[model samples]
Target: MLKEETVRALEQTARQLRVEILKMLNTAKSGHTGGSLSAIDALTALYFHQMRHDPSNPKWEDRDRFVLSKGHAAPALYACLAEAGYFSRDDLKTLRRFGSHLQGHPDMNKTPGVEVCTGSLGQGLSQAVGLAIASKLAGRSARIYSLLGDGEVQEGQIWEATMAAAHFKLDNLCVILDHNGLQIDGEVEKVMNVGPLGPKFLSFNWHVLEVDGHDIQAICQALENADETEGRPTMIIARTVKGKGVPFFEHKASYHGVPPSDDELTRALEHLGHS
Candidate 1:
């Protein structure tokens, strides 16, 4: 259990990550907005409080791995990486620029902290599973984590990887589903529903836990439960608001692939208590 002070600090970090997510997207003028904001709290809990990593030595062999399988949400990962000291906070301003390392999608070859190139969708879990397999083979205790969008689970590869994880009993692996319910087209259910998500995973043989994604304390507890489970991987179904924090953006599908305009950015900042 987290102390009250620790929970408050994590909440503040999540808010700051949201602020940076907006700042980067607004500056780039192109990037996913809704998904990034929706996933920042989990990303925050991972980088700041959960994952074992060294920003100064990103390639350190002992570091635990994180794969943002929903690679469109790279802005959130980039923001957390910057906060984790993987790079200068100033570098965030150059996101999506012609020569920037912080590209629209996560590029492992280009970005210092990214575990793999993603954004093609549905491939990130495969990559994470492979990493977990390698960790087990090497007799390393490093755990692997993947964050998937609810819509992204529509991909066949995600299920394939899920089966592999359970078959291999990758207890060192944990998957998070950002169930914000909105995708580029609008509601995920309208596009192609993947509801009854928990039951599906349970049938696939994964240890499943559902929680309000924005609740930092509950998120922390879920991570703890994942750690305690043995001989099986864990899946945390995070029920989240598509565009969290900013009122106008919340649950709006239009913001999925859109960047906040200068005017919208000002309003967003005000809503986030920055103005």
Candidate 2:
């Protein structure tokens, strides 16, 4: 249940995420813009409104954990973590630079709030399952959440982890698929065709929900519902645009891994109400 004011705050936070993402990529001159921007709303809602995390004590034993399976979206995660007070926002400019804590991919040892080093894709869910299983064995109630790219789900390992999580009745684990439809090669349908995704998760013995990935309230509700569900892992198949919010980038596959140019970044910030 999200209060109206909290909803407003989340909207503001989403805008801030977009601004930071543009600024970070603009500074780094490399990284995935489409996927990161598309996942911003979901990431913002989790870090600001839902997850049980401590900025000061990132490794707190009882805190909820998040694994960004689609680790190429590290820009969005870094922005969310910084806004949540995990680290100073100024570090954003150092992304992908040598000796910077903010690397191209998240490295848990180097970055303060990153829970896992996940850039290879299709592996975070398995790691998340292990974490959830450990929590159950330790009698801790912490939940583990993983965000996967829809394209990454094409890998065989994803379904293996999916089966493992359900077989073990890891109800404390929730996975969100960032269904932005486009991947680096092309549209997911053309790349590998992992459609019927909602039913696919249901058939795998997991509870399934679908939501607009850009809507913070809907994202929160899906997460809340996942928490209440019992006896199985939950998956939220979030439908999103490849590049969201920016006029030129939205639904465009070319921007999948391309940073916006200086002119493009300026226009994007203006579109996001930052200019």
Candidate 3:
């Protein structure tokens, strides 16, 4: 179990990251807000506590890698990378701006800490799987991590990658599902149900774990558990709210692809204790 102080610190960091995410999205005036907000806590646990990465040496050969499979949540990854010192936090204001490194989707060539060009949806898991295979072949201890959206599971390519990850026994790969239950069109089930996810992944031979996505200690413990498991890739199904922090936005499908307005930003900051 994590110490109380450590858990509080992590929770504080996640709150701060959420603030950054909201500010960046509001600045851009165009970005995915709901999914990004939903995924930030799990990302906070990974980048701040779990993953072994060097911000100054982002290209370090032995470093663990992270892939944002649900690339629309780029703001969540961007917030973590900036906090981790991959780039200037001030650069966050440039998100989605023309020629800014913080684009609508992750681009490895453009972003300092991004591992692969993503946002194609369903392709990032395969890329992560390939990275795991390469690390294993090279005898490197680096682990590969990826995040997926519950709605994204509707894509067949995710399953293909799932099968491949298990077939290769890529024990080094861990994937987290941002099970926020709502996508752009509507509630995930109404659009296309993808529940009973645990059994499905287990059927593909993955080691499955479920947790509250917003609980910092639970997330960290699950990650630690993934590290200790062997002979199969692990799938962490993280149950989360669509818009986590702000009362008005929480679980609202309308906010999925909408950035916060100036007034909304003020309200959000107040709710987040940033005002």
Top-lDDT candidate index: 3
| Model 3 lDDT tens row, 1-275 | 88999999989998999899999999999999999999999999999899999999999999999999999999999999999999999999999999898889999999999999999779999999999999999999999999999989999999999999999999999999999999889989999888789999999999999999999899999999999999999999999999999899998999999999999999999999998
lDDT (10s digit) by residue, model 1, range 1-275:
99999999999999888899999999999999999999999999899998899988999897899999999999999999999999999999999999999988999999999999999989999999999999999998898999999999999999999999999999999999999999999899999998889999999999999999999999989998999999999999999998899999999999999999999999999988887
Query: What is the clash count for each candidate, in the order shown?
Result: 0, 0, 0
Q: How close is every model to the real structure, measured as TM-score?
A: 0.99, 0.99, 0.99
Best-to-worst lDDT order: 3, 1, 2
C-alpha lDDT of all candidate models, in order: 0.94, 0.93, 0.95
In angstroms, the error of model 1 at 137 is 0.8
TM-score of 3: 0.99
**Residue runs of model 1 more than 4 Å from their true location after superposition:** none
Off by over 4 Å in 2: none
- Which segments of model 3 are wrong by more than 4 Å? none
